[model samples]
Target: MEKMGYQKNWNLDKIFLGGSKSNQFLDYIKRLEVLGRDLERCVKSYTTSLATNEAANLRKLVEYIGEIRVNLSQANSFITCLHSQNTKDQDAATLRGKVAQIESNFEKKLSKVKIILANTKQDVWESLIETKELEDYRFVLNEWRENTDKHFSDEEKNLISDLMADGYHAWGHFYNALVSSINVNVQVDGKEKNLSVGQAINLRSHPNEEVRKESHNALESIGEEKEELFAKILNHIAGFRLQVYKKSGVKSVLEAPLKDNRMKEETLNAMWSVISKYKKPFSNYLNRKAEMMGDSSMKAYNFWAPVTNSNQKIEYDEAAILITEHFSQFGTELEGFVKQAFHEAWIEAEDRANKSAVPFCAAFPLTGESRVFMTFGGTFLNVLTLVHELGHAFHNYAMKSVNGVNKRYPMSVAETASTFSEMIIFDAAMQKAKSKEDKLIILDEKLKCSVMNFMNIHSRFLFEQRFYEERKEGIVSSARLTQLMRDAIHEAYDESLEQPSTYSWVWTPHYYITQSPFYNFPYTFGYFFALGIFAKAKEKGNEFEKDYLNLLRDSGSMTVEDLVMKHLGEDITSEEFWEKGMEICVKDAEEFLKLTSLDDIE
Candidate 1:
């Protein structure tokens, strides 16, 4: 694999002919538009009750909506893939706007269908879902009906959907553009150089303390410069959401995110309760890390600071081999998928100018394929990212045979497979460590994961929660937002930092997105969820491999609680279950302490 020099750019031609300008792509767009219109016509033509026609029209509507959804996903994925590689590509941006319009139009039509379903008699709707054609989509239909029950009139829903294209969602795009256009000047080798916000943020973990501080100050300066504009962006986005919630008669803002996560409020509270008890261990680990780095106390920038001095670099091909070897010990199926993802042109792993800063894996339901995006910098963390994304790709592969509608899992469970894959690589490296330093490096990575999921994400969740609570009263000023974020950080982590981060709310993009309200907690939920499953796998040994795949395959078809109960035989809403997960983090921290002490002799 090293000799082959694996393909680093994705083959977009597999999605379309000429990457957005092709005749084939244009024809496909027209077809999607026609399908939307036809579906609308079919729904409008059904005036009688569902029982009058044996749900024939309802079945047709479900199939048509599914087809439209799959095609739209393919189009959106391709345009995003193109835009991520070249942020300045106007053609890709224009196509994305057009796709957004198409999606909004489809949503309008679907809203009408939902209104019709909501108006149907309960007995009739229940019987209609029992039909052979609609059997697989039972959960989907029920969810639509439930949401419609809480919504306003069809006219208002359609208006909201139409306005969101240029109203709510446009603000998110505006924020993205604002941050992307920012370039910070930093001194490198005694020379001033310009770096993108994404590039500068990555420097927080740089080996040099001065460089990390410089990078952190540069990023905070951007927030200071544009504080008012940033405040307006957040205020309006949250304000618009509040207006919709009020009109829909939603009493609590957390209702939608909790529903989106397929979880109950009890589960979230229980997990956080368990999480709070384990923070001391992680704080201790951070203090030890600070001492290892010759510092008395850890600051915000020092959270991701490296513990070991090893500078070993692994090539892209070598990283692939390492991942394959480690995964082979678990199962042959996963090993094969990882190899195929690299051997084929399914990943864009090269580091270049103007590319997106984030790493993600996008799955195309229409083609039953997925594409992963990342810049491979040859670090151990980068290797972990590769395996993490491969875990996502494997999840998509596991559900290829299932229906597209059923394949949509919540954000909470979405990270289960990815984090599980990271654990595999983490343990493999720990076992292969030949020296104390090597083992320390591996332990550092594990402890860093614990700190991130336990502390950093907890602060984010608190910030969002408070931001929403205040946004409902009135627009929050930039200073007020800063204070709120600082308070949240203080509550989550009791570390006395040299310089506290007050601009976290401004640079973090999670607050700007309207589609998912509380995106922060799902990460913490996913880490713990995967940790619990991994613990079970360890206890069951190789015999659990088949059940593991089965669990992944069913992730999309059922609720998280149901999936856990059936596969792991544990109640996720219980405090005991969450405690079991948090114990893993505590155990890892204790192990790190033992490894660092001279009394330990293996």
Candidate 2:
């Protein structure tokens, strides 16, 4: 293997000192299972003392919950590292199931706490959480206690949580396993070659027009062939969710996602309202790119085709230096932390095959360390990906240090730091570009990401939104789901492309995720939320660093609206704050269009 700059592999040995068969890892799980039993006993005691020593028992229960959380985070984060580093590791897979069972056992007992809080009278509950021992966790406890009547009773809620581990989550795991077996055949250099879904996704960006089109059609055909099984997976998961909502007295499908994101409907409405007005400029960029490629219009396949005939690659060490140096320019301590992540070999960036292609950063709570996973192909896009995952690592570093439930934040605000890191590096790339083409590459890369958040994600959100409305009537057939997908694509693209992607529901994994509902909008929320933060940094200059770090720290402790007001002092439930993000996208698209319209290419 050719050695890249900095060691391409991460140091997981420091965490466990051995691989999947480590005896130390086994001992850790044994200790965790013992703790789970203790938590169950603590819950039992708390329920028995409800009348006499209610406050004191509740405090004791909180301490147990805190300890259990650290145990779960350490174990789960370690197993996730094992799996990502080698997807074919069967022992790692078996250990994941073991860790999951421990987590399930923990959740069963934890559900009792939620139900107890739900039944508590509002005045009494307020006074209970206001006590010295409980005040630190008031935000999370109040979140559960606020919507008391809309939830199930103790017996019903416990049954649902237990069933989900086997029934609901199993369906999700099966869908993932099934998708892994799908392979697409395409013609490559006068020979037929088989491609995995991940490989076919890469071919969509092939400079040759025919290759791009072939890969897209092959994947679409597979979706059509597998629609029946995929449809069952989609319907069963959604049907189970809708049934739970009906029993819980929740009126709309959006309610769970809104509450889960720790955000308000008004804020979601405000963000999408601004997004709805920005499609024309993005569509113009797509049309202009199609023209540059000598096509009358853009298709779903052509959307990823490169307009610049440049093949530029940045080495991993160069990317690391660029990311950390620029990160320091905007904050008090971001740069130093980034240097530690690189020098300590905390990132898994080896470029290899048979490895899971998903990229992420996992945080080990007890160790106060993080592991970043990605196959770092040498490109500007890869550099940005490294920067993006580091942003997530830094967010975890800022949060959860005090080790309580409040350290855990929602998906919406959790994305703030990662997206902000990308913005900082983006500025650095443009300012230090050695040539016009390099600058154009940076612009094109930014526009592609912006377009996805702006247009593609909107289609997913609209499709899921409408699918829920119709699911209330009855089970939507596999055929109707296709049309529903088309309806969303049509509305979101709005004459932007010659042909839009319609078989998305057949391939999109978001619809099958059992835990996260409405997996689409948090992305847009995160993107623009970071843009708002970036715009603030630009407006306030270096002094804004303190607030930026402070905001990341507080993300887990408050509602999205409350966090925004406390940090930026901006009204996010209105259109004005969201418009700032759209403006940044608009300017990027316009700049891309200007650069591509030159006579030199002609």
Candidate 3:
């Protein structure tokens, strides 16, 4: 039996088999959906009726809806997990689709409620919140009120929502397919290797310089061939986004992401400002690395190449123990969850055909259970992968105690706990480094990752900004988009790279993502955010843990600033708050310098 606490193999049958096919399950679902619809209607009717402050009625409606929503989402959690685990599973896929359609139908019906609520007097909303029975939903009601200004006429809002299925979303799918299907021919040891997009990218991290450069060339070559289509997709998506942003009265498309991030412009500016200062240190790190590799200058392709040496391959069991021991510092709850995750086969770690390429965790919210997906082939990165996914699992654990209504954290904060976990475990690993070469290898890994979050992610953010700005003018040509992307990259990495080694072509896939523009900033944000928060924990000692957990607990309930203030007493909108994180970045450079002694290595 696997020793991890949670089982890796999920019981999809719990959701859809046995009693699932029976009338009881079907009846329960139908009745729940009906109740949901009814509750929504009640809220709308009461609000629109203007019948003598029906605060009690509103409370009853919210409570009923909350109960039904929890049950419905419990069922949804199972279906979602099964669908992801086996997208080809016909029955599961059908169930998932049906659930989604029902949910959308519910959303459409609820739009009426939103419109009604929007028309409600501010005094009425305040009275409802002050009512004993309705107080539970105060947060939800307050948030809705905040969004009232963004609410368009029901007709336009509904039309836009429905239109996305055919328009903007389709562009995103096309872009993904184009990138995923791109074939690259890489030369290795005098042999030509045909690679998928992912394989080619992974090869950029190869120890062999020739392999990395060849892979980079192959990737860029394939991207060049598809540039026109990629540009068209980017332009169409951006145009669609701009139209919607204008319609919604958002100043820019970035406003939504930033608002959604619960952060302000100053926070981002401060983070990048600090990152900008470290460009010199990064340049030094790269230079030192190049000298160690006996190269005059390093190309973009050689960025992920291994430095110095790594330890002997660790067994999965050994890695689990190491991670468990490291995570124990957080508390027994986190440790036990990590242990359960490994023991119960909650992790699909085996390398198998027809499996996902990246590591991720999916939570079964109903049971507060989670499954981790990854292909672990015993590399150190594989261990880190486990740690990262387990970080997500830990987040799920923290959220489990929250109402399902308040557990869905935004994507920007979604990475916070996971990245925080990575730092904790990595620090432990770094401390145990046994030799100078091992220390170099460890520091190199840290520095490379830091560079990616700061420099690479910054480049993507800049390109996306330009893409959105220009895309408003209509479709950008492939060549024009490429040039804009190059300019964005050069601007972000101004002093980070030495002459003649820049690879501006890397913005290809990132710019092509459809659903979220500026998908890149979240990474850098998560990194610096966690670091800043981590620094607070170090200063305040054990007392900070409660505040931190409370902040996490409120992630679903409050604005990002509110959460930060509750936990770390810092305003996310302030430049100083972000610069604190940046200062840590500088300290990181100093540590790298102190530990590695680049002079000797060079």
Highest-TM-score candidate: 1
lDDT of 1 at 136: 74
Ranking by TM-score: 1, 2, 3
How many residue pairs collide in each prediction?
Answer: 0, 0, 16
TM-scores vs. true structure, each candidate: 0.95, 0.93, 0.86
* Residue-by-residue lDDT tens digits, candidate 1, 1-602: 34667888888888787875767878888888888788777777776345635566677677778778888988888887887777777788788788899999888887777777777899888778887877777887887777774457667777888789978998987887777677888876577878877677766666667777888988898889899999999999999999998887888889989988888899899888988877888888877777777778788787666676655777888888898889887777888888788887889888666777667898887887889998886777788888888889998888777765667788888888999999999888988999877888888899888887888788899998988888889999999999988988887875644466789888888889778898889888889888888888788877777888889878766778888899989898899998888877898899888877662321
lDDT (Cα) of model 1: 0.82
Cα deviation at 15, candidate 3, in Å, is 5.7
Q: What count of clashes does model 3 give?
A: 16
lDDT of 2 by residue, 141-251 (tens): 778667544456667766787788778887987776677567788986677878656556666666667888898899888998989889888888888898998987889
In order, candidate lDDTs are 0.82, 0.80, 0.66
User: Which is the winner by lDDT between candidate 1 and candidate 2?
Assistant: 1
Return the top candidate by lDDT: 1
What TM-score does prediction 2 earn? 0.93
